[model samples]
Target chain A: MPTLEDDDLVFRFPQNCGRSTFRIAFQRTLRIPDSDREYPLPPGLGTFPLRHAEDFPALPDRMAARGGVVMPMWQAEALWINCSHAGRDDLPVAVKIAAGKINAVTGEAWRPGLHRDPQDYVVAPDQPWLDGFASAPGQIRQFVAMPLGDGYTAEEQITGQAEWGGLQISVTPMKRAAWDRLRKAWWPGLGERVAYLHDNFDRMSMGLGAGGLMRQRIEEDPHDLADWDQRATERVFVSLVHAAQWSALTGQQPPTAPPSAQAYAKAGLPWFQHYGCDRPALPGASPLRDLFSVAELHKAQTGQVLPGSQDIAAELPVRPFGTRPREVRSPGGW
Target chain B: MQRSAAPSFGTHVRALREARAVEDSRFSLRQVAARCGVTPAYLSRLERDESPPPGAEVLVKLAHELQEDPDVMLAMGGKISDDLRAAILARPRLFADLIRALRDTPEHAVLRILREVRDGDW
Candidate 1:
C-alpha cells in the first residue's frame, strides 16, 4: 500500500492498486462546498472524460476554426501565475514550457528542494507520474500547480496523483468551517451572479483567513468580497518586495478567474471549463469567463525581474523554515 | 432466526491495524510484528487467518500498544472473560463507541483517558 502523511490528511490506496491501475488515493474524502450544501467528494481520481470542440462530425468544416477541446472538472479554479520580469535584458519571456528540474510553467530553475522540515513540501508535478487534461490551445498545462486548501480543486486532484513520498505541493483551506465563516461574512451573496465565482473560490481572493498574525496583516482591507479580492491581488504584488533572489522575483500566485474564452488566444493560458468565460451553448461550458480581464489588469503590472515565490511555508510552520526555500537566479545565473 | 458466526481474533487484529494506520502514517505490518515480538511471516499468517490466535501475553501487549482494552480484545480473540463479555454484550451501543474511540483517538491520549476511567469510580 502506498501511504504518505500530511498534517491532517492521510493518503493511502483504499483498495488494491495493481487491480485497478488508473485510480489515485486520497488522504481523506474531500469535502466539496457547493451552492446549496457541502457533500463528500464522489470517488473521483482519474482522467475526467473529455471531447473535442469544433469537431461535430456533422459540421466537419468548422474544424479549421480555433481548434479547442471540451472538458470539465467537478471543481477547479483555472489559475495562472504572471511572473514579474522587470530589468532582465537577457531573459526575454521568462515563462516557457519547463522540463526536468525546471518549473513547467514559469521555466524558473526548479530542482526539488531538499525537504528542510516537515513543512518543506515540494510539488514534484512529474514524479509518481500523472497525465491530466491540458488547458491551453497548443500549450499543454501539464501540472496545474495550485496551492492546496485554496478551496479550489487542482488539476492534480481531479486527474489523480500518488502520495507526496515527502514532496508536497502545499494546499491550504484552514478548515471547512472556517472557510464558510469567511464566505458568509464577506461575499455580496449575489446568488448565481458570483456563484460563478466558485462554491470553491481562489486562495488569493480569500486572504489568510483567521490566522493570528496572518489575519492581522490583511485586517485593514475591505471585508466585502469584491473589494477584498482586489486587495488580495495588490498584496500579492507587494509580496514581491520580500524576494531575496532574482528568480524569486517572477513568483506570482494563481490567477483568480477561470481562463477566458480568449485565454489561449490572448494570454497563452488555458481557461478552466467551469471558471472561465461562459460558453453556454457547449456541453461542458461554464459562465465564469473573467480571466481575460484579470490578465489584462495583471499585464499592466509586469516587470523585468522574475517574480518571487510566496513563502507559505514560513507562515504555517509557526517558525522559520528549518531549510530555507531554495532560490536560484535563473536557468543560467542572472 | 439464523445466528451468524462471529469474526475470528485475527480478523479483529486486521481491522484495528487498518484504523490505526489512519492516525499513525508510519504504522506498518512489519512494525506491528516487531512490537509483538513475532516475525513478519508469523504476523502475516495470523492476519491472513492461516494461524491460530496468539497467547494471552501477546494479545494483552497488542491491546496496550494499540491502546485497546486488554479484556475486550481477549474476549474477541475467543478467550471469553465471562464478566467482561456480559458487560460488553449488555451495552452494544457503548461497545460501538469504544471501538470508534479506539480507531479515532491517538494511542497515548486514549490510554490516559482509559487509565482515568479505570482509576476513578466513573
Candidate 2:
C-alpha cells in the first residue's frame, strides 16, 4: 500500500525486499503551449496537495473503488512525476505510470505485468522524473490535464472510450540478488541518501493528455527483465478531480494555476535539462506518436480555439546540470 | 486514534527496529544489537525506556544498522552530534545568538533561512 507522507505518495516494499521504498510527487509546472514547438523542462513550481480518498465523505464511486489518494488539478494544467527513493537513491524500482488506464510510456493499454522489449516502465533514481508521454527518442510530450470524455484525453483518443479518468501506478523493485550485486559492486560505503522533500486542487474528474513535447529522455532499462521482482508489485490509482470540484468536495481552496509559459520566461527562471549517460532511449511509442495535441484536438472537434493555446516563446534559456554517470554498467569501486 | 503521549526515544527506537525486523529477518533486534555491538537484553531495555539513551558512539552504530541518519538518531536520543558541537564551539557566540534568536520562529522561516544560507541567495 502507498501512504501519503506529507504530499508524497510513498510505496514501501516488504522487508524481504530490503525495505525498498519509492517516493512519487505530482509537480506543478508550466503548461507549455500545445503548438508544434517542443520546449525545455519548466521549473517545478511546487507539489499539488493530496488527500486520502477515504478521508472525505461521499466520494465518486469510481474514486472510492480505486481507494488510493485524490488530488485536484486545473483543467489544462501541466505536471511532471518526480521520482525518488528513501534509504538509497540508486535503489532500482520499476514504475509503470498510466493515465486513465493508458500507459504513459508505451502508449499502450494498461497491463498488470511489467514489459521489457518496448520497456513499458521507467526505473527510478536513474530516470529521476517523467514529464510526459514518450513521444520520440529522448523526447516526451508533457502531461497536461483535460476533462474526461473530451476527446482531448489519451484514454478517449486511443481506446475509443473514457472509462478511466485518473492515474494508475504500479511499482516493482529489483530482486534481492540483483540489488545486492549492484550495491556491492558500486559504492560499498555509500552514505544514506537525503530523503526527497514532500510538498500539494478541483472538483471535476480529469485525465492526462499529451501536451507540448519537451527534451526529456526515459532511460533504457539498464537491468535485465529477470532482475525485477514481478511477483511483488504494488499498485495505486490516483484520482485527479477538478480544482473547482476540489473546493466543493474537500472544503479547501485549490492551488492557483501555475505561471504561464510567457510569465515564466519573462521572469528569467532557469529551465533544466539533465545531462545523462550514453544509454540509448527507447524509440517513441507508435500509438502515442501522431496523437493530436489538446489544442489541435479541441480545435478539430469543436472548430474553436482552446484557451491558453498561444505559441511558446522561442529561445527560452536552458541550464544543463547533473552529469549523471551510468551507474549500472560501471565496474566496482569496491 | 491519536496517540495519547509521544513515544519516548527508547520506544521510538524499539518500534523502528522491530518494524524493520518484522518485514526483514535481517533486522531482528538481536541481529541489530549484535551488529551494533550491544547485548540483546540491553537493547530490549533500551526499547522499553528502562535505560537512558545510549552514548553518541553507540547511537551512531545503531543509526547505521537501522538505516537512519546518525544526526537524527542523535537528536532523538537528546544528544548533539560531536561534529555539530565542534562547529558550534568554533563560533560559540554567533551560533548561540542565532539559535536563541530563532527559538520561537516558525519552521518555514527556519527553512527559509537554511535555503538562503545554502544557496547563498543574498
Best by DockQ: 2
Worst 10 residues of 1 chain A by lDDT: A209-218
CA lDDT, every model vs. true structure? 0.28, 0.77
Tens-digit lDDT track of model 1 for B3-105: 5787777787888787777666545888988888888798888888899888877888777656566777787766855656687799979987887868656
**Model 2 lDDT tens row, A217-237:** 888998899989887777877
Candidate 1 — what's its lDDT? 0.28
Q: In model 1, where do residues sit more than 4 Å from their true spots?
A: A1-334, B1-3, B80-122
True contacts kept of each: 0.00, 0.00
* Second chain TM-score for model 1: 0.58
True-vs-predicted CA distance for residue A163, candidate 1, Å? 63
Best by lDDT: 2
Instruction: Look at candidate 1 and tell me the lDDT of residue A40.
Output: 14
What TM value does model 2 have? Answer: 0.69
Task: Please give, for every candidate in the order listed, the TM-score of chain B alone compared with the true chain B.
Answer: 0.58, 0.83
